[model samples]
Target: MQIVHSPLHLRHDGGMELHRGALVPCYEMPARAEYIREALVEAGHALVVPRDFDPEALLAVHDADFVAFLRTAHARWREDGRDGFMLPSGFPARGLRRDRVPSGISGAMGYYAFDAGTPIVEGTWDAAFAAAQCAMTAAALVAEGERSAYALCRPPGHHAGRSVYGGYCFLNNAALAAQQLRERGFGKVALFDVDYHHGNGTQDIFWERDDVLFVSIHGTPETEYPYFLGYADERGAGAGEGFTLNLPLPRGTGWDTYDAALDTALQRIADFGADALVVSLGVDIYEGDPISAFKLGAERFPQLGARLASLGLPTVLVQEGGYAVREIGTNVAGVLGAFGACR
Candidate 1:
């Protein structure tokens, strides 16, 4: 499998994040991708830097205004004479007027963000755009008939929505890859997000489109980080009515339980008869993950890959959340190795 990557991912080095009521060093660090890159190199997989694509590639899935805000957010913060990372102090959630756009940087931050977890560093836009390019490049490889490809995206997406950014995510990488595949002539695509947290942003982007089916198996929203969504009852709406599937598992879930949900998700993809598959591969479900509740063991990671390989579709594995820095490399390698070996 070809691994798509870029050094520009290191640009987004936000030092801190607001989590669990305290300001902590950001868990989504650059080393995460470095570790995975090391593992891929050791396993004899070749890494390729992605070429720059037009912003319209991103505009295909994200709102143009939101993309513009990300590109200028740091500059705006600097213009306002701020010193640290740019973070949203509030959100226009629930009954608020989200229609009108704000002119000031602070108000724009609140208007466009969903939470404070995603802080914008000086290189945030560059890193996020590069990561999206990595995903798109991998998707193009799959479109060109490569069996599968891997995109080691940092500032892990699946959290950023069409017009909102949070959860350490600025752009929805996996969603963009799926959209790229659709643009490349794939009639149907399946996005299976196996992150510990729900891919709220991905679901939001494709929730109304039948061309791409989105399935997420995550911690139940009632007790997870993203508390507003990820319920099993949240099927899609309008033309997307039955195209979305959510399998929200309880905390402390392990392979025995997770395997079942994954099987169900894979079955849905098979039934949908999609032309390609995109896996939002997040190793955060590992038992040692500091911020997550799943109990999946190291040995079980390969099984996750094997199951996905059973589908036999052109796949793009986009990197997402995995906070246990030490084991993140091994766990991610496990999935990719097994998937490639199975093929």
Candidate 2:
């Protein structure tokens, strides 16, 4: 299998994050990708760097204003002589009018972003851009008939929405990659997000399009980072109705329960008759994860991969959230290796 990555992703070293009501050094640190790259190298996975893509590709699923904000927020923050990472103070929730896109960087950031978890570092835009390229690189491989590929994206996406940025995401990498596949002549693509948090951004991006089937198995919003969405009942609307599936497991759900939900998700992808599978692979489900609640031990990762392979679909694994930096490699390698070894 091939692995796609870029050095630019390292620029997004997040500031402090809340853990058990105490601010701690960020778990979404630069080392997360470092360990993934180390593991991929050890596992003999070929690494490729994605070329720069035009801003138009990102424009497809993101508001132009939000995109502009991301590109300029850091620079603007620097121009303002603020040294700390740029973070938005408030967010627009369910009742707000999302139709009005902002005109300035700060206004745009506030308009699209959700909370303070995702701070805009000096090079966050470049890092987010490179991360998107990494995902696209994998999608292009699958489009060319590759059996499988892995995109080790940092500032893990699946949290940001069409115009919003938060949950440590800016450009929805998995959604962007899946969209690229559809635009490149793939008849159908399935986005299976196994992040601890729901792929709210991905869901919003593809909410009205049936071309991509979006499925997520995440922590119930009732007790999770993103508390507004990711319910079992928030199926897609319009043409995308019935194409979106969300399985919100409880806080302390273990491997057995997670595997069951994963099985059900894979079966839907099978039943959807999709030509490719884009997995938003997040190992935060691991028992040791600092910010998540699932009890998925490292040993259970291979089973997760093997189960996905049982569908026999051409898969593209895109890295997402997993805060336990120490075990990220083992869990990531386990999934990729199992996929490689599967018959």
Candidate 3:
């Protein structure tokens, strides 16, 4: 498998986030991607830099105004004479006007962002754009007949919706990759998100379309991050009815339960008769992770990969959340290595 990455990802180095009523150091750091890159290299997987793509590729999945805001928010913050990372102060909640975009940078931040965890730094746009490029490159490789490819994206996307950014994700990299596969001639694409959190952005993008199926197995939204979506009842809408599948596990879930959920997700993908596959690979399910609540061991990653490989469809693996700094690389590489070996 060809692993696509970019050093530019280091640019969006966030400073802090709002967690547990305190501003703590951000868990989604640049070091997450570096650790994965080093492990993949040590494991003998070839790494390649991503090529540039037009902005239209981004507009295909994200809102134009939202993308523009992400590109200029940092500059806007600087124009306001602010220093350090720019985090949202508040959000448009019930009874607030959600239709209008605010004029000031502070209001705009809250308008476009869903949480305070994702900070907009000077290099956020460039780094996020590079990460999207990596995902697109990996998708291109898979569309060109490679059995599978890995996109080592940082600022993990999945929490990002069509027009809102949060959960330390500015761009929905996995959604972009799935869209690329569709434009590259795949008739039907199945996007399976194995991240610990629900891919609300991905689900939002395809919620009304039948061409791409979205499936996720994550912690129950009733007691997890991004606690609005990811219920079993959210089975898609309009033309996409029955195309989306969500298997919400409980807190402290281990390999046995997670494995059963994976089987159900994989079966749904197979039933969809997809021409290609995209996996939003997040390894935060590891018991060692700081911000997440799961109990999967490091050794089970290979088993997870092998299960996905059993589908036998061309796949693109896009990196997502995993906050255990030291073990992140090993867990992610283990999945990739096992997938490659099985393929």
Task: List RMSD in Å for every model shown.
Answer: 0.9, 1.8, 0.7
Q: Write the per-residue lDDT of candidate 3 for residues 1-343, one digit (tens) a residue.
A: 9999999999999999998678999998989999999999999988999988998789999999999999988998989999889988878999999989989999999999988888889999999999999999999999888999999998788888899899889999999999999999999999999999899989998999999999999999999988999999999899999999999999999999998898888888999999999999999989988988999999999999999899999999999999999999999989998898899
lDDT of 2 by residue, 70-103 (tens): 8878777777667767666555668977777555
Model 1 agreement with the true structure over 201-245: per-residue lDDT tens digits:
999999899999999999999999788889999899999999999
Q: Which candidate, 2 or 3, has the higher lDDT?
A: 3
TM-score for each prediction? 0.98, 0.95, 0.99
Q: Each candidate: what lDDT?
A: 0.92, 0.86, 0.92
- Stretches of candidate 3 off by over 4 Å are none
* lDDT agreement of model 1 with the native: 0.92
